[model samples]
Target: MQGKALPGFRDFYPEELALRNHIFAVWRSVARRYGFEEYDGPPLEPLEIYTQKSGEEIVEQLYAFEDKGGRKVALRPEMTPTLARMVGERAQALKKPIRWFAIPQLFRYERQQRGRLREHFQLNMDVIGEAGPAADAEVMAAALDIMRAFGLGPAEVRLRISDRRVVVAKLRHSHHVAADELVPVLAALDKWERAPADSERLLTDALRADRARVRPVLEFMSGLRDGAAELRESAAAEPLNECVQRLGAMGLGPFVEVDFTIVRGLAYYTGIVFELFDQGRSLRAICGGGRYDDLIKAIAGVDLPCVGFGMGDVVLGELLKDRAKQPEAPAQLDAFLVAVSGEDVEPVLKLAHELRDQGVAVEYGLRHAAIRKQLELAAARGAPRAVIVGPDERAASEVVVRDLNAGTEEKVPVARLLNGFFR
Candidate 1:
């Protein structure tokens, strides 16, 4: 019986794998340069750990079940909760200001669409145990640096910066909304830009009892722009203003803007928040993060200030394609050994293995194909040079080296071939 694969999931062919590896290599290089230690967690974790931090709303969006032992578990939807649990487990002994990063295959049960899937990879970067606004700026700068590394300029993407503290402060000071009611209110306000006018009004009314209290909330909502001047005048705009100036002083202001409408949907975010958006607004957030100063203590029972962000491989890949930057060139192998006839196969395989042992990526022609066909295959497989082991070469203990690009060939003794080809 033939079976079809599920939607929103994909199998990576060799070509696709090469592209994925190339993208990941760039990510790793930039992450290391910024001093983030690589980290990872189990693909599955206790269901309660996610539910505890993400709330019941996440249950509908997660692939969760009970094992045979009746222990509840779920595929990890995100890595922050796992990071918190891991750090909490060793909170007492671990040093402060832990800088960590991970690229994990995350799964979600939500419906799939452009730039999203039931399963995808995400790069998570976090800085733990630093609470100051500078810490927030540093995280933002790191994210911006990654985008710039991918060739995204200020015109291509902008970091929409906001502050949950400013949102909370506005709700409490301007609207007199109780602390208990703030989360839902902010969740509603987060969609104010996209929601219908009536729907936004209904949400605003639910948060504020008096029309006077609601005025500032509406004004703050209206003041959402790409400038700092208007943001400073709004009641719910202080934290965002502070963030703007900090990023500006660091010369990162050009890449960022104040957008009070960018209330991140995550519940744990407690301070500065931002989301990177394509200039066209043609897709969802390319990356996003915020301060979660209470997260470490909430999970590990130890107080620590932390900020970080996650960039999914899917959306960024789309953006890269849109920008015409997806790499078309495959990685090259050092050499492909072409065996001209059946009798030449063993020697060809032996030479390939020897080259591999010396740290060269080498492939041997498995089938006894024609010399022309073998060379074509080598070129197609992105081998820069081809080593021809014909009957004459085998008898003379020599190999013919051909540069595919330069279209040049030379004969060298077997003893000197390795160094000759490599050097």
Candidate 2:
């Protein structure tokens, strides 16, 4: 009987692993370019770490249970909680505006979808202890640069920027929606903009305010969609505005879009929020994060203003495939060694190891085999060249190097063959 991976889990065969590695390479490269030092924490942590920020209800969504030691623990579903505690512990010694990034394989007990999965590697890039708007722009620029690294451009993806304070201010001044109803109202707006036909009734009911201060404000809020679509009046929008300008100066203006509706579903975001969405907006958010000023203090018990974003490999991979920007297929062996005679096996083995030691990916059969069969195996292994060692060539301290792709052959002396075959 064959066992299978659980639903929503992945089995990364060679080809799939190639794509995964490509994603990781780009993630690390771009993150390093932004001056973000890589950091990581244990995958399993005390359950209270998450509970401190999200409360007990979050346990239901986590793979949380009691350990054999009778300690409550859970697989980490996100990196922020751990980041908070780690940074909090070193808050004094660490310099301000700390830049760190982590690529963690996170887990959650949730239904799987096109972009959402139970297990996936996420690139979490955050700037901590930085309250200025430039930090916001820096993180956003990092996210966009990752997309650009993979050949995606302005036409393929869009950055929807919003400030939670601006949204609340506009809603309070116009819709008269109470603080108690803010979550639902903002959620409804988020849905209404995406799935208007479905959320029409909910949004209509949400906007139906009996207070006299509501109608005009509701009208104004609704008109925002058609207006300049900029919140120039709010004080909180100033930093957001500065962030946008910084991105513009960095030549990323085309990818930016201001939509006040992006009141990120999370309650922790205190200021600017942004989500990267595909131009079509068909899948889930490609990436999302915002300025969470007090989240560190709340969870880690140390105050640190942080801004960051998490981009999962699953959706980003899918997006890359859709755009035909995925990396080329994994490379094959650099060379295959074939010994023409039983006596030649000794030379073949010796040279194979030397090539391998020199960092060339060379493969050879373990048992005796005919030269034709060896060449066949070399082709099967996708080696573009075969180093053929025969008694005649070995006697002369030379080997026949066959260029399989070009169907050409050359005899190079054994002295130079070790380092010169690949050359």
Candidate number of the best TM-score: 2
After best superposition, candidate 1 residue 338: deviation in angstroms? Answer: 2.7
* Residue pairs of candidate 2 with colliding backbone atoms: 174-217
lDDT of 1 by residue, 1-423 (tens): 566568888788876676678678878888898888998999999898888876888889899999899998999999988898888888778787788899999999988999999998998989888777777777788888888887888999999887766666656875678877777667667777777475466665676556666666666666655444644677666556666787788787788877667777566788788899999899889998998888878777878788999999889888888898777775468888998888899888888888888888988766778989899999989899899998999889998989999999999888997665575
Worst 10 residues of 1 by lDDT: 222-231
Give the poorly placed runs of model 2, Cα more than 4 Å off. Answer: 197-222, 228-230, 330-332, 420-423
Model 2 per-residue lDDT tens digits across residues 1-423: 588899789999987898999999999999999898999999999999888767899998999999999999999999999998899999999988899999999999998888888999999999999898899999999999999999999999999898878777767765567887777667666665668654545555665644464355445546555652456567757888899999999999999988776767557888888999999887788999889999899887888899999999999989988888988775478888999989888888888888888888999988879888999999888888898999889889898889998999998888887756566
* lDDT of candidates 1 onward, in order: 0.81, 0.85
Model 1's lDDT to the true fold? 0.81
* Clashes per candidate (backbone, < 3 Å): 0, 1
Weakest 10 consecutive residues of candidate 2 by summed lDDT: 209-218
- Which parts of model 1 are misplaced by more than 4 Å? 175-181, 204-216, 226-230, 233-246, 328-330, 341-343, 391-397
TM-score for each predicted model, relative to the true structure: 0.89, 0.93
